[model samples]
Target: MKRAFVPPADALIAFETAARHGSFTRAAEELHLTQGAISKQVRQLEDRLGVELFRRVRQRIVLTDAGRLYLHEIRGPLLDLTAATRQVMSYAGSEDVLNLAVLPTFGTRWLAPRLGDFQKRFPKAGLNISVRLQPFDFGAEPFDGAIHHGDPVWAGAIAEPLFDEEMIPVASKVFRDRHDIATPADLVKAPRLQLSTRPLAWRQWFDQAGVAADTAFQGSRFDQFGMMSEAAINHLGAALLPKFFVRHELAAGRLIRLFDISIAQRSAYYFVYPENRTLRPVVSTFRNWLLEEARTERTDPETMLPS
Candidate 1:
């Protein structure tokens, strides 16, 4: 069997650093190694690869085409490795930490208010939070779990339902009056704002409103709900936003519901964790607490708890 043609870790590090700085001397300073040692490591790497990675231009160095490509490939992975290392280093002794990737707006509006109670319940459980706009492979990323929206179909994970979502059309009061958007059908011609993630949001609302909208899918698009909401407040266009997220805006009159109707979003909110990612007790603890919080937060005549 043939082994991978991977270069030594230190050699790759030296090469990347040198390419970034365009000087072995500067790379050595950053890496805490002598310039001579940096040069030696780079020479050994080039000899092993059988390619000249850099062009020596007087006291400066410039990457060759191959070197540029190699740098591009290795730089991202190297940064990921460094981040993973730092995340692990943050752990103390036998204590467990639950690292989570969360949607920014959800983390703010839905989860932030309840976090204090979670801390009171479990003081020792450490949690690390980072925002991610889109889903990624749970097996590949170093997160313990995520607060995900949509279907319970994360490839290698278990998605526990958090609650359902209903999107209501909203716009600034000024914009609504300007366009005289008194009916859902009026939105067919008015500029519509959309989330790229929910491309069919307007179509779903129009269908429920009993309005046949051919241009429903046509609109300015955004990636996050927060951006779309802000755009709506600034009178960019009418947008369908989660009722749960826009309560404050509606109360403050920053944004007003364009109509009384709302459409069920395509999928439900979920507390998703990789099935085999970790065996830490905090993972289950957090999930249990989160589900309970959801139940309490939406205590209507019909609870929104997972069935």
Candidate 2:
């Protein structure tokens, strides 16, 4: 087997900077090096690659075709390398940190409450949570795992089903009272809030409720459930939301269920991670703990209805 040829890090940095600035002098100023040093480093990189990386157009510099291609290819990897280096350096003696991506509303409402127990059990384990709305490439991102919604279709990942979701239409009590929403059929007359990702949510809800209304899909859209919930609370419109996400609001009477209809969500939440990816002890421990927590959560009533 033949070993891959590696270029000097300094030379690559110099080339990238010079290409970005379009001037060796500007690159040198930014890098805190002399212009001559910058030029020499770029020249060395070009020589090693056996390609002319830049062209002198009057006093300005332009990247050659090879240079542009290389820049495009290396930029992401270089950034990833820098980020990894910084993360490692910052946590020199710290405990293992598990980077988990989660849905914004779920992380805030459901997972956040249970995290304290995880911390108590694994005091030395650090859990870093980031909001991720959709499924993403596990290989590209630094996430150790993600809380994924929908089917277990993320390629190359093992999805451990957490729990199924049931959605219900909810609105501010003022809105419901003002609009005089007596049944699911009356919801069409009231404003209907929509989730940007779930464009067909309201349509599905209408179908389940067995109501046909022209205004089912006419309403403002929100990217996150948190924002949508706030909109519904503010009396902007009735929102079809997961039962778990609105538990507190429902319990507090801030948001009232408009009808006794609850639709089983087509998808469920899952704890997902790459199949072949190595897991740190902390990550593995959290996975096990999370499954147990989900199991211990009180079972939903056969019918979730307004009080």
TM-scores of the models, in the given order? 0.80, 0.76
Per-residue lDDT for 75-97 in model 1, tens only?
Answer: 99899889888887767642678
Score residue 98 of candidate 1 by CA lDDT: 84
lDDT agreement of model 1 with the native: 0.85
Q: On a 0 to 100 scale, what is the lDDT of residue 68 in model 1?
A: 91
Candidate 2 per-residue lDDT over residues 1-307, each given as its tens digit: 3334678788888988998899999999999999999999998888888999899898888998998999998888789789789766645555888889998778989999888888888878876678898888988888899999899889889999988777889999899888988888888888889988788888888998899987878999888888999999999989999888898898888898878777777788899999997888878998999899888653655334566
- lDDT (C-alpha, whole model) for all candidates: 0.85, 0.86
Give me candidate 1's TM-score against the actual structure: 0.80
